[model samples]
Target: MSVQLLIAQLLLLILGLIGVATAAPEKILDHGGKALLALCVTFLAAQVRPRTYLKLAPYAWGVTLLLLVLTLFAGKGAAESGGVKRWLEFGPVRFQPSELAKLGLVLQLASFFSRRGVQNKLISVTAMILLTTGLVLLEPDLGTSVLTFGLGVVVMFAAGVRFSNIGGFLLALTLLALPLADRYLSAHPYILARVFGHLGRDEQVAVGLDQIGMAHRDLQLGGLWGQGPDAPRWTYFAAHTDLIVASVGFATGLLGVTMLLFAYWLIVSTALQVAQLATRVRPMRPEIHGASILASGAMFMIVGQALVNLAVAAGLFPVTGVPLPMVSYGFSSMLTMGLAMGIIHSAMREVYRAQPALADGL
Candidate 1:
């Protein structure tokens, strides 16, 4: 196994066990079973051929587009009220189309930008990203839409798109968001509550802010050594998902949080190193360009989402439903992350396979 995969698995194992320990007895088996399943899926995904991805890149985008449209019409809300329709259910199995969209967008963007005449295709690429972002936003999932849009821009930038064009697009987006924020966010009580809380405006915000403050206190209560896995004070709403960093801090203290951050750093940095290596080999084969973009895009998504989740837990950002990658107790998230890691592993495999040829050329 690759070192990146090993580190990811180790992080997931540690966090999964922590989740199980903190969960109610009835839910313990559920958490454990899903974690095991995620591991199996991740392992199998890693074995896919890189060339297979190259061949399927176009079709992948089509499937994702279909899923996105299906989600708009048939997706279920995560909450009974005041939540957007973001999930598609099939009997006992439920999944998020947006998660799949994230991976699809990354792969599609990589394919789009890796080719020659990318400059001429700029308008089409921008339109594709905007359409995807618009679809995600229609789900009223602001966090994910922003993340998806950002990931596309990051891929474009990495592929050497002009900064001026990126700046113009972002400025236009910001202008458009202002009116929408006022019109829609004002009408959504729960969303308004979170936004108001961030802006220091509502009583509901106080509740969330207090939870964040309490999370900090919990960390302090744990100190350097933590209060232990079974500590009563570790409890909080969404403790196993959104606020898991705070839970870890409560259970394992500053030490555990530090270790978790270090693990994330290693994973992200390794991905970047792989991207850099792929770039050096780009001249030898066209596929290397796609691989480099894929590596960087995956790195951006994983690391960006992880940081956002951590920031929310730390009270640095207003709470959104963004879950910590690999560590959260959501099957959909686990599967998406697993797929991303698998693709990165495939890219890494290709890079290493080409190393001898690259060396001989030198």
Candidate 2:
């Protein structure tokens, strides 16, 4: 499809969702952020040149790294919840540098692979992971840390990391992570409670049981067609962002949830198709830099984060305050993700288009 048509569809879907959610009016401003971000993304889609992105990657990575350092030194010393410092206040707006870092890291890796086949792409990727993850972990933003790290591994995998190596790395990661979880659980009562709940421990289950119990109540309240858009998800107060799927379940019922899932599946599937097509041709093969691999990476980052956030809201995992991509109510998340989508869209625009022959030039 043409880029303009694609952008229109995205705008329609996003705006439609926001309008639907606002009918009952929980947090309209937050949903508006989605629209605002999409607008910025659309503009960026037209402005950025693909070749320029190759040069921008190094600067992007450097700036992201510098932001990470600034967060440690001057970020809001502590969030309301704990020692985590994910936000840096710019008078009125709070910025999450890690979000930018996720994109920067992707661009960096893409640029590296586009140049020469690096024998140790995995090692280079891991170094980048540690640099970003270490900074995020210090902020105690475990959710973004996991998301960013996961994105890095995925990009490396796309660059053709051996499966055997991936297996070993994952195993090592699992071992290292377990002890951290254990230490965290030991250090914080809330962490212990959450871990215990996740582990199905009876004692700590009640800490968050009210939300679960209420969600079930909301589920039962919704019949086949649902309570309708006018129905308010008051019981699920965090519904608009963190527990949005539950809100959909409550307000629009199971069918709405099914449709939402189907829609995203379509988006991701379309991305995969573009990637696959890009992998086949030659003149525009490098264009695949923004297509299959980077597109896949972006989808993974967005969808993966949504699933994790949803799982936490469902009490399947400990709450980590991660927002649902495109659906969530955060300026940084919406805009950054929109920007990343624009980058991918630019890649797709050139994906199957015929490139000018080199000899024909002159």
Candidate 3:
């Protein structure tokens, strides 16, 4: 098997085992089925040529935008008890459009930047990014909104947008966001509670803080080798989802956590290397530059989400409902990640095919 496929499978195996140990039998079976479907989707996507993807990029973004609109009007509420509408239910299948929006935005931005006219259309590109990001924020998924925006920023940076321009835009955004946040927080006090609840003000906030503290304690209890699956003190909620890293720590200790992180590091390192190689080739194709940007953006999304999830699980950051990339039990997230990996693989294939000499040297 290729390194990408091998590492992905191993990560899925680890997550599957965690599901079986922590979740219901039927849920574990469902996770397995979804994972298999994701693998098949990824396999098919990997076969798509770079030219085909470019042809299909606009349609994909249209569909993604349409889904976001549908979600805004008729989407289901949060899986847990909350008023947020982030998922769309089609018969028995439910998925998050915001997840699809991530890729759509990345591809659109990559295509926009790969062309020679990027320098003249910065305003238009920024408007597009803000519009899509605004729609996501309306989903009331603060985490996904922030992530999508950050990915856009990274893509622009990779495309050689100046630091002064980026900084000025961010400053203006922050200034505009402050009043909006204050107004929104005034209406929805619970949001503020999540941010400042550790201060012992509200019951819900206290419970959230307590959960973080307990997660910390659980990690301490695991020590170097872990307490195994049947440990009596494993009390963290969402142990198989947002808190999977904590679950791993409780069951397999720091060693398992380290190994899991190392796998993520390897995947990201390979992606960056592929992107660098794509950039280093002489007389590079425009499509290759676009592919490199796509690969880098995908890596940032996966690695960034993993880091955020780990920070939340470790009680070092505010709870953002971010799931660990391959380890978390969300079908939408899994499918999105699978598609990203496939795209990266396709990009790598194109790079190597364009430079047979480089391929031979590797």
Screening candidate 3 with a backbone cut-off below 3 angstroms (N, C-alpha, C), the clashing residue pairs are none
Q: What total of clashing residue pairs does each candidate reach?
A: 0, 1, 0
Error of 2 at 160 (Å): 2.2
lDDT of 3 by residue, 1-362 (tens): 13764575467557546644653344677777777777777778778766567667778877898999889899888466466888899888999999899888877877777765346647767786887798988878878888889988987887667888889878988998898987766665556677676555677677766777776776777789888766676455676778767666777778877778887787687677777788678897788887777777777777888888888776666778887876777788888987877777777777777786776655
Q: So what's the TM-score on candidate 2? A: 0.84
| Reference-based TM-score of each model | 0.91, 0.84, 0.91
Model 1 RMSD in angstroms: 2.6
Model 3's lDDT to the true fold? 0.75
Candidate 2, clashing residue pairs? 275-292
lDDT of 2 by residue, 276-345 (tens): 6666557544545545566667667766776787687666777666876666656777777777667666
Model 3 CA lDDT for position 223: 89
Worst 10 residues of 2 by lDDT: 353-362
